[model samples]
Target chain A: MAENQKLCPMFEFAFELLGKRWTGLIIRVLLDGPKRFKEISAMIPGMSDKMLTERFKELEAAGILTRNIYPETPVRIEYELTDKGRALKPAMDKVQDWAETWLTPPDQNNGE
Target chain B: MAENQKLCPMFEFAFELLGKRWTGLIIRVLLDGPKRFKEISAMIPGMSDKMLTERFKELEAAGILTRNIYPETPVRIEYELTDKGRALKPAMDKVQDWAETWLTPPDQNNGE
Candidate 1:
């Protein structure tokens, strides 16, 4: 919105992607490496297949990640971050840092 | 969710706040300094008073910002970031930098 005119319009862009449900979590999964559609979805407990596909497509359109269609009888697709996507890691890192430092999230599953 | 058990639960916490509509914008306004309720809402074009109030309460509860009630002719209230709030700047900085470098936002109102 006004961000385009303001100092950090990119924050708006970044948020447009990350702000959606399962988007950041998808990226977080890829931070370790590339994964197929199912691999990414499995890591996030409650994400729907429809929602996961939406996030993947959005991230792909943004040039943050790419999809590879394997040349096989049954083509397989894997998603991986591009250089730009990898570059986004810093922001996520800082958010993680900020959270650990200042936040105490309520425990739900509290998986360990 | 899995964040609490895996790693970087704070990212989840940070996202829980920032991902909500108008939440990041509220924090962004406070970054400059404290502001009255009306002042913050004016900066964000279409933010409802209800939404702003909700975001303010959330951030205050998170300890990222604080509220002050000055006993003037009538009580004057302001919201300002705490040291913890200031600490969250780097994460936002990184996101802004990533956005500027890698993203091109569509312009609407284009306010400068």
Candidate 2:
């Protein structure tokens, strides 16, 4: 395809990847550094293991993240952002800034 | 709340809005100018009326897009980006840029 083709499908695909329930949170957690599966799981409190695995695979396939396995005694596995994934920071930041401006607090908005 | 309260929830919320199946396409369609509902719908060929309605209401509630009603003979309704919605351009651009980089052409990739 040409370089400057219309980006509707691309935007749709990215939205699809980012739109998964815990996908954004997973990327946010990974922003700090490479993380073990357990570490990432711990950071996102309510996500189930099944969902995490699914999102990880989707992200990996999309080339947004990379997974590495070390030849340690116990076999350590870690996930980190690829350059593509890191490039998402600015976009994610814009969303974060908008959310801060518009959304009510969880407690107050939800009356928790 | 503070300007930056970690932002995970906000990111999640924005992702939720952007992630809806037709939501990103809707935003992309709207990029040109304010569009009437039918105009928007025409741009996205496959979407059903009910889904478009749901996404439009959701985007409005999220403070991203605005709806205007004119009391003409036919009662025209139009949708346009709010300042908040306009702010999303950069983020959306990044996703589009990434999609162009990663995704194969629909015809080739899907073997259509």
Candidate 3:
């Protein structure tokens, strides 16, 4: 398994990373634009500060999001999706459409 | 958070379910067509039988796939994606495109 993993490009790794607990929501928030730590946490309703910080680091490592630190009074830090990360937009849009079209209200799912 | 979650459609649940370990592979396997238990298991290189069974049941519950029992010489069970499951094709295609174009071989990621 380990040997074969290298032969492949590791899409599963990307899928699994994004698939992690609150990571999808985190990506969605970033898709709109770059956001500070607190702003990201606010967009996602129940996510914790610890989880948010952890996810940011993890995504940064994965090359999905970039963390930029600004030189200022208090030093502003923001996270933004990279080109690879932005590539996920179409897929995410499809999911949102699926959710709005089929997963909303359960009853509305069969409306089509 | 709970109350707010109810107000919004649960896209996260669907994303999380598909995002689960081996679940994305499972969905991808089913994308071609219905398959028997072993067939689905074969496509995913290292997933455990226990985990595959669990994902199938979970996806079935989520209305992503339907289970059918065929009464022939012996008894056979096959799983196929529902309309909702089929609806995921566009998104999955985007992911696969991203994988092949941007995620493949790492070096070829910047192929564009």
Candidate 4:
């Protein structure tokens, strides 16, 4: 049906947030637990600090995650998912499953 | 754990493909059925023909979908997903479920 062909607005919105470079990896890292900026950057090797900072702002603005500042000898900053972001586990899990099933073994080199 | 913090390569590859703008939407549209370039462009409002064309090339190269050309008076062409792409239904479904649950309703205008 023609109606079925049209992309759902909500799905579009979801992808708009999720379908950015390093967003999924950032969320995936946070899904485990709160981590500081350096920690997240370290987890994802290719992602630059600037991109991580940009994604953090977007995710925070989207209500998917929150930035926490802890007062200590030196203030510590951490990024953690909100309930909404935590709920993305099932979806993220599904993506991981699909990746395992369809993606080639990581060891095998396929010329990019 | 430090080990757990590292991003999985397979997951990273999958997101690299899916995280690009309009990739998910294009795949989602094809999941319904095969359609021509014009049909796909029409279905997704605001997506220019150039974008759809680019995504089609990438998806084809990835072995996710194939382009079939029918030798007819008009030389009809259509694009369909391969098994690998079709297998993404579960992951896509999960994303849709998450969107329905967590994303704000389409009706409410939130300043972008």
lDDT of 2 at A2: 25
lDDT tens per residue, model 4, B40-104:
88878767999999999999998899999999998999999999999988887888788777875
What order do candidates take by lDDT, descending? 4, 2, 1, 3
Computed on C-alpha atoms, the DockQ of candidate 2 is 0.42
Q: After superposition, how far is residue A19 of candidate 3 from its true place, in Å?
A: 2.6
Candidate 1 chain A, run of 10 with poorest lDDT: A1-10
Off by over 4 Å in 2: A1-6, A106-112, B1-6, B106-112
Which one wins by DockQ: 1 or 4?
1
Task: Name model 1 segments beyond 4 Å from true.
Answer: A1-10, A41-51, A106-112, B1-10, B41-51, B106-112
- Docking class for candidate 4: acceptable
lDDT of each: 0.76, 0.77, 0.74, 0.80
Worst-scoring 10-residue span by lDDT in model 1 chain B:
B1-10
C-alpha lDDT of residue B52 in model 2 = 90
TM-score of chain B of 2: 0.85
Q: Assess every candidate by TM-score.
A: 0.75, 0.77, 0.75, 0.73
Provide the RMSD of all predictions against the true structure, rounded to 1 decimal.
4.7, 4.8, 4.7, 4.9
lDDT of 1 by residue, B38-88 (tens): 888788877789888888888888888999999998789999999988887
Clashing pairs in 4: none
Considering the two chains of model 2, state its CAPRI-style docking category.
acceptable
Fnat per candidate, as a fraction, reads 0.41, 0.58, 0.35, 0.39
Per-model chain A TM: 0.82, 0.87, 0.77, 0.82
Query: Tens digits of per-residue lDDT for model 4 on A2-111?
Result: 43333356665675577666777788888889999999888777778988889899999989999999997789999999999998888878887887678756675677
Top of the candidates by TM-score = 2
